[model samples]
Target: MSLHADAWSTLASWRPDYYTQEALRQAFLGYLAARPDACQRSCAAGHITASALVFDAGGEHLLLTLHPRVGKWVQLGGHCEPSDSTLAGAALREATEESGIADLRIDPVPVHVDVHPITCSLGVPTRHFDVRFAVRAPRGAHPVRSAESLDLRWWPVDALPDEDGELDMMLAVLR
Candidate 1:
């Protein structure tokens, strides 16, 4: 199946744990039904993005990157690629690329979804329909900071600088 179809099927079959998440899932399905090119960045209105919240081997620390463009600490992820076959795969790929850490294990199930506006590489403002997943880092994992980020570090989950509580929300739904 196509990546777009995989996204639709995934969301359609997922049973969100919260009412808010259910609403987001419905919104994603509706958006996908209306826009065939919704997974592509060229959609102009918005596009699907895959991201991962990386947990340490022991699950105490969460890896985050200070995005150079947004200048805010955010999870590792980006726009979906044509080569991606599944949303989980796209998210895992992004996490590996941004964190520079291999052998990360993805949950396959979505942990969260968000919509936000940004002027990305397209040079115009657009909304990002973000699909988030949980990923586990290997033991003694050493992260290499990518040029895409201003800084990369593992922050204690309890003391995260998540101003919007996005990270907390992602973690909360899992438990």
Candidate 2:
């Protein structure tokens, strides 16, 4: 099926009150509809995963990863495995594995839900239904990078690497 069709299907499964979710869904659908070959395969049917935009207790900094694939700084997240019963569980797992921080805790509420299409290093396209949660880490918690990231650091929320539009969007959400 087309990416637009897949986005619509995914959006329909989510709660409609979330403006970010709807907006992202529409944006992705529009992009896909405009470019049928944007992605190698439609990820509309893939299992959704959770992610954390973790900030220190001071809230002045946010944990970010320089992704091994995209080579962009982003929140901690990955695919949902069959063992993960909930999106939050999958996100927490990815966060701990990638960042090597065991004390991270997500707030009870979700910060945002975003659905976006990404092209892998091989130029294969896939969709990610990222349920973003807000989290607070203990002061002075150091991050250790895993294979998924080239580097991991806590960046000041006000100062982020200047790059693509996607980074700006993510920063806005993180802010």
Candidate 3:
């Protein structure tokens, strides 16, 4: 199946909260319909990004990265590469690459969807229609910071920084 078809299927299966159900579904369907290159970075109108909210084996803590450019602690994710077959695969690949933990297991279902504007170093401001999934890290896993992040740390799920909206989104999905 095409990546776009996979994204459509994934979104169709997601059961988002009442607050986001209609908006998320509409945003995803619109993305698929309006942009043929929705999976690629060049889609200036907006593009689909995949992210993983990673928790430890026992679910006590969440792994977050301080994004260098964005200057905020956020979930592990990035642009969808051509090699990724599904949004879940893109999220898992991003988590593995950003956290340096190879044994992460990602739930195939999307837990949340968000549309937010961002301006990368290369282009004009664009929106990231992010499909987020939950990932459980290996027991006793140790994560090393990648070049994409300024720092990497495991924050207790209950003690996450309140300033980061991404944390709130994660908490909502995990609950």
Candidate maximizing TM-score: 1
Candidate 3: tens digits of C-alpha lDDT, residues 1-175: 8888899888877767656655877778877987889988888878999999999999999999998878888889999988888999999999999999978999998888888899964479998998888999999999999999999999999888759566775687568
Assess candidate 1 and give its lDDT.
Answer: 0.93
TM-score of each: 0.97, 0.69, 0.95
TM-score of 3: 0.95
RMSD of 2: 6.4
Higher-scoring candidate on TM-score, 1 or 3: 1
lDDT tens per residue, model 2, 1-175: 4433443454445453547656865665565456644333334433245688878879888889988777788888876554554555556778888888878887544556666676643356656656666777877888888988889998887787747655456556545
Residue 171 in candidate 3, Cα distance off native in Å: 1.1
Error of 1 at 144 (Å): 0.5
Q: Tell me each candidate's RMSD, in Å, in order.
A: 0.9, 6.4, 1.3
Worst 10 residues of 1 by lDDT: 166-175
The sequence of per-residue lDDT tens digits that candidate 1 reaches over residues 92-115 is: 999999999999999998988989
Comparing candidate 1 with candidate 2, which one achieves the higher TM-score?
1
User: Which ten residues in a row are the worst by lDDT in model 3?
Assistant: 13-22
